[model samples]
Target: MTKQTDSMSKQVETNKNAGSEHPPVKEHYKDSLEGSENNSEGFLAEVKAVKRFWSPVWIVPILCVFIGLWIIYEHYSSLGPQVTLTTSTAEGIEAGKTRIKTRNVDVGIVESVELSDDFSQVILTARLSDGKEDFLRTDSAFWVVRPQIDKSGISGLGTILSGPYIELLPGVSKESNNTFALLDAPPIAAPDAKGLRIFLESDEYGQLAAGDPVLFRGYQVGTVETSAFNHETKKMKYQLFINSPLDNLITENVRFWKDSGVNVDVSAQGIRFEMSSLATLFSGGVSFDVPKGWSAGQKVANNTSFRLFNNRTNILEREFKEFDPYVILVSESIRGLEPGAPVEFRGIRLGTVIEAPMNINDEQIVKNDNLVIPILIHIEPARFTELLGEQFNVVEQYEKGNIKGLRASLKAANLLTGAVFIDLDFYPDDILVQEKQTFANYRVLPTVSGGIAQIQQKVMLTLDKINKLPVENFIQEATGTLETSKETLVALNDTLHSVNQLLSNQSTQELPAVMKTTLHELNTTLEGLQPGSQGYSSSVQTLQRLEQTLRELQPLLQTLNQKSNALIFEAPATVDPVPKAAKP
Candidate 1:
């Protein structure tokens, strides 16, 4: 068989060299057998014939085929679920090159990018890796991640060099979805992060933004996750995330406020500057704390709402409870009585002024016709609410107290500082009754005459009295009196001069000696009328009475010479009260 195989092989080789078809099998075998008899060893003669369509030599090509089939299967099987995202614009995206990532992990690639039917938005079709199709759920969020700088802070910095990509935040739901609207910017904080979300509402947004820190005391415990303006409420709503454990600190009574970077206060105490943190200076932040004097309330539920105060004091002032309101009708200046000023009962503050002073015009004049300053004051019962008990309503109690002479007045809280506050007290006699007497809403609290007002009124009255005095008439009367006195003094001086010349003459000197002798003779006769004599007693009594009469007449004569008209017109009584001497 070996000789036969060799002869056939040789014949086949000669046929391939000649580039010709093989001869007939009968002739070829005959030629092969003849050559086999002359061959040295017959290996083919010892081998048995096997009937198999597939041979061992065919294994190489079959294995290659199997590998090719496997590669094709894998190419299709490994392909992920396709998702389409609609974006505002296709500025930074490129088909087949852009990728989708979650927490920086590459999970998908963009397959194609096309504009919508309306050309208003760009649609992105992307293929997510196998087994990740479950991530596309109802709550799934997708946004284009690119370098962005906003009031919140710088974000997507990694995309600066690597180009833009789509970011995905998987939802918590079991359900799945494919199509989604792309966000213009990334979500403030990842929704899937383990934490709690609470909302805050404010009238002003200020520098607050997403990704700003949420602080407890001065340390950052969480962040402001998202924010949106609510038109219905006319407020800006913010979503705050507090990381686990620390979130336990939040209670129903917790007060939240914006950390407006730098805190500066210029007061009589001087300027004070404080900063919560450097991060807050850039991105701004939200801070919260349980207000003092209030118990830690119940643990807050997720998405609980609270007010976002603009300053720290506002949060601290949350303790005030406005259960009632009263209008302080001030006639004096309210220069320092601004809104938010404290309203005190005695020295303790019980409430605050919620609104600015309102002016009330009137045709009727108060005293000197001054327009009254009407201010709306909100009085909180919380300060004394507990003392009054829960059964009693503060508004009702105030109305009752008002009838008992509870009044509101403005007083200078700080004279040097010019700060004024409302003082509520009981002034029974000075209860200013209002024309409209009803406690329907805010009662009009009566105001007493302030100290300053009384002083002003007294000064005005004194000036009026001074204006009514008759000064002109008095001056004329005094001038006439002085002229009469001048004439009398000139006449008296002439008489005195004449008497002096007569006494200086030689004959007048002898006349004074003769008068002295006559006086001596009269004295000798008077001496004979001794003590205890009726004549002597009568003389002494008469002399004493005459001296007393002269002394009384001296003041009467001086007044008669002076402004006698004043004594006649201004005296309380013109009739003489001094009794006449009795006739005995």
Candidate 2:
């Protein structure tokens, strides 16, 4: 208390000095100090009344904590659906590097790659972008896209530099899926492609497979989507997709056939060559078209079914509806003849051979006396309808012609191939005719030995005649003639020996010298008669003298022809003629 009072007195003394110097200033300063003290007290009061919830020093760390939580939420919210993919191989795939793409746009990334539990397959876990979750639909396809060369063509060429990636083909299915089996190859058609889908059923697989082209005429407009063999039906079933607009070409009457690309047909008519394109030639293809004389029918819808014919000819052969069946009994060997061979009228195909040597058993052959083979053939009257008029009935005509010597004969269709066809023609000369015969419940068409069979029969008959000749008597006569010939030969040998002996004689040896002398003399005579020889010169001189003498006798011969006594009195007529000329 004493120290506080001393300090207060000192301050009062200093204030009194300042007040003595400036009294107004001293009073103002005392008032201002009192107000400041009050303000300071209020400030202290306000500071004491407030409560502290957090420290400013912790602002950074607390903000960091909340920011981290927000970041984590954002990360989880941005993530797309995760999918599992199973494949046979892990080639060209990486856990984090490989991407999933659709239409060349990346939509996801492979999160990890691992083997299946059995280690038989590769499993890929992939996460798609937020909005791309729809790509995981049931019908969607995933395949590893890499550089590949195949019969279809070179594909995924862009993967060569950018590296292989997974391709996602979004499906049209409404259902979604998280797990999928990767395709070994790319699908032939996009899942969402607008087109008509049809099924083809075939007995033989042939060269058809997925990715083979489907052609209309010769233009490719679609692809074979799938080729599967059905075990239950024992037939090959193919799924096909025809692009829009062109898909309209498909109709009920249209027939589908395996287009081997190159069609080479060799028959009795000749060789026919047809080729669609080089692309089809290598990969094979299917072609559809309405057969001749048929309407295109109604347009086919998606999922429609059709029968796949083996070839165009097979389709044509089965197109006709009305036909007549007949059985022909052939005695000739049916070698080179087969089912499906043409039954022709003249040269035109009027029917097809349903079966050759039909239903022949060992017992039947043993009991049969003639050993004739039965052939079943069906003649389509439609083939002759255009030629014989629409009213033409093949069955009635065949029945009528049966009595008029109509016959079925085996004729070689192709000489080189030895393929024979049934030839129906009239044979009025045929003697053995059974007009009302029936074989195996079918009307019989009379048959004759014709074509190569007729030639063979004639040859056999000739051999039979030759075999029946008088061989013993002919041999005896031949022996006598041979003896006479031998005697003649011996006489000729004797004559030759006589000639040899004569040639060995001296006179005969001199005969050559005589012949040589005679030849030399003849040659000399011929030389003397040549243009520069003495005989030629003498003949020329004689001809010249005779020509001059003939010229001299010309006037005398003329005078003798005019006068009877001109030989004795020719000099008088010349003087008389000269005197008449002088008077003129």
Candidate 3:
């Protein structure tokens, strides 16, 4: 373009001169392009010059200082070093928002949940406050406290949804890497983390939840951590976190059952136990009591078997496989019983039953194509054991020796529902009172012990009594008396026949007249002898006696004459009329 301008140089020079004259327009045009390369270079140079004069090296240091301060603040204020706490109670506990507090001061944050190496306890990871280095103790007790209930009594079931608070019991052990145990509340027992995991099954009343109390002799000894259903076994599984101190108290003889009332059946003795109370109306719990003397202590009964019973269902479970009252294994027969059908022990209510889920029994019985529930019965071992014997004093006083007063009882079992009852002083004469169903082949139970054995003996004695009565002698005596009465009637009938024959014979009738004359003569002689019989007075006496004798004969003749007249004449038939109707 420049070369082309050569020819036009002269023109261009003239144009340039013109352009110079119009410098304002060119400048204005250039100025319109505010971002022109030349202007941009000049602006850059000016900026460089100003920077060379006034730029500050101190600014970088200041900024660095500020950034460091900010980093320090973040490090100090943010959640601290990560820590983990394991507790028995997940109750009253929440994640993320839960805080681990030491003397009411926030110490750490719950990070996450993890499984312990032993697989016994739940591990909760937490980030402790940066400055808080010491809080956990080796012997620090940990428990998750929520609303709970057990053998000891009913308590909170309230803390489940609420967040958990960590209570740090500062310890003196200086080990840097401490076993930071969890303390949800006061510990029931020191955690013996023996790596033992056990389960229990119970109903709403019988169930044990996390943070619920576990007790021995009414003293809290452990807590519940988690509850679940075991699909493999098909029963409920509740984990009991035991304290190290009281865990050993559980003995082979230590049996567990539900706290709610149920009917218990003692089948052989025909005894039933049914005790009801208001507490048993709704919720249930677990309870236990040792026999008066039968104990399984002195050695560890750790692997001992436990029995589960449901009085309501009348089911007895042989094994409580990790379950207390929850593991009641009902026989299929009892399992089929309807709800509200009572279970009785010697005529008393031991419990009532309900429909339930599958159980841990390897051999589960099915009926009617429906599931067989694991029957659960609520029982307070303490309360249940108290009723076996009566206060004998009352019975003793009731029996007065005067009339050979016999106080006997007959134990009977309900035929329809299998409940049992005791009939005190029942009269055997009333056969209707006894159950009609009887054993085809009756074999006595192990007549073991006191009043029960006496009852059995009495029953047998009654059987023998019917065999000793005298039926044949009474029959023979009745026959002899009937024979004698028959003879007497026959003799009387023969005598009447003879009299009729005499009346029919004319000659015999004449003989009757002669007998009458003889009787009159004898009467006259007797009267004369009794009156005066001297020679001179004899004649007079004879006359007088004759008159007296005639008078007596006259009365006899009159009677005979009347009888003859009646025989000769039939009496007239006449009807007696009612008195004339009163003047109507």
lDDT of 1 at 96: 86
- Global CA lDDT computed for model 3: 0.49
- Order the candidates by lDDT, highest first: 2, 1, 3
lDDT of 3 by residue, 1-584 (tens): 23322433364356567765445434433443454454433321110112255458878989999999999998767745566667654544556777766655777767677677887887787777776555554554434445656655764443456544665655455654445676444543333354223445644333554555554544556665666666766666666655565566666565555444455665434457765444443443344445454556653434333443443323232222321121122222332234433334334543333333333345434534754335433322332344554332222233332222222222224444544222223233543322211121221111112244466578879878866767688779989989998999999999999989878999976987899999999988777666355544877778899999999889558756656665467645447978887786
Candidate 3 ranges with C-alpha deviation above 4 Å:
1-79, 83-103, 109-127, 131-226, 241-248, 261-271, 274-283, 289-298, 301-307, 311-413, 416-584
Q: For every model shown, what is its TM-score relative to the native structure?
A: 0.57, 0.66, 0.34
RMSD of 2: 16.5
Which candidate should be chosen as best, given TM-score against the real structure? Answer: 2
lDDT of 2 by residue, 1-584 (tens): 34433544575577667754444434544554565565533311111124588889899999999999999999999999999999898888888899999888989999999998999998999999998777778889998899998886798898899899988899888999999998878888887888899999988865588888899888899999888899999999999999998898999899999888788887654567877777678778899899887889989878999988866767876756788889888777999888888988778778888888787554243224777788899988888776777455545665765346677889988887778899887777874555566666778787888688878888999999999999999999999999999999999999999999998999999998999999999999999999988899999999999999999999878877788786676456355344445565
Error at 136, model 2, angstroms: 3.2
**Superposition error at 242 for model 3 (Å):** 5.9
What TM-score number comes out for model 2?
A: 0.66
Task: Output the lDDT of residue 477, model 1.
Answer: 91
Please say which candidate is ahead in TM-score: 1 or 3. Answer: 1
Q: How much is 446 displaced in model 2, in angstroms?
A: 4.8
Report lDDT (CA) for all predictions.
0.76, 0.82, 0.49
Q: How many clashes does each candidate structure show, in the order listed?
A: 1, 0, 47
What's the lDDT for residue 214 in model 2?
Answer: 93
